[model samples]
Target: MANDFEVGVDVGVDPDAAWRLAGDPVAIRDWFGPVSDIAVDGDLRTVTMGNGAQLLERLVDRDDAARTYSYVVESGIPGLTSHRATIRVVEAPGGSRVLWRQTATSDVEGYDIEARLSGVMTAGLESLRDRLEGAAA
Candidate 1:
């Protein structure tokens, strides 16, 4: 089954500033708490999670003018057959809104993919909002 999740958070910073950090493929570790390290080679990215598990992803598309980037996970996650995610930063009323969206399919039986991924996305967005807002303060 395919699971879709989307999470967004508004931060007190300009969109460009948020994009400058969020749009960078290698800067995910700075905002996404679960990510401990990241290495990027061209369009490929290797992410090491806090638990030391790694995920390999391929950059699908990126648009600096739109402040958005998308990627597809290639390997390193058990049971995940397919996973594609996109992150975008847009101007909001007071600042900028960071939106994270994911579509994933898993072969694991009875696994609650939405619950798990949504939690991670929500927490990551909160962390991003804090980091960007703090830097602007």
Candidate 2:
């Protein structure tokens, strides 16, 4: 079975500013803590985790005008069968809202995929808010 998760954060910056940072695949390492580094070659991105694990992802869709981008994990993570995620930035009253939604499936039983992914997404959004808000301040 697959698990779905969505997490978001409000930052004290305009949508354009937020999108500039979040929409860029290569900039993920700047705000995402677990990502130690990322290398992008065209529509494919290779992400290196802090623990030396690597994940390969392919960009499926992107709309700069809409401030949204999506990708699917082609490989990486033990037992993970499929994974897709989208990041979006939209205008909010204070500044902008950044949303991250993920759907994932794994072959491993009792793996608690939701807990793992949601925790990481929450922490990453917090980090993103801090970085963007701090920069705006």
**Model 1 spans with C-alpha error above 4 angstroms:** none
Q: Write the per-residue lDDT of candidate 1 for residues 27-132, one digit (tens) a residue.
A: 8898888999999998999999999999999998899999999999999988888899999999999989999988888888865567778888899889888888
TM-score of 2: 0.93
Mind giving the per-residue lDDT tens digits that candidate 2 earns over 12-81?
Answer: 9999999999998998898898999999999999999999999999997899999999999998878878
TM, every model: 0.93, 0.93
lDDT of 2: 0.90
Count of clashes, each model:
0, 0
RMSD of 2: 1.4
lDDT at 17, model 2: 97
For model 2, the superposed segments whose C-alpha errors exceed 4 Å read none
lDDT of each: 0.89, 0.90
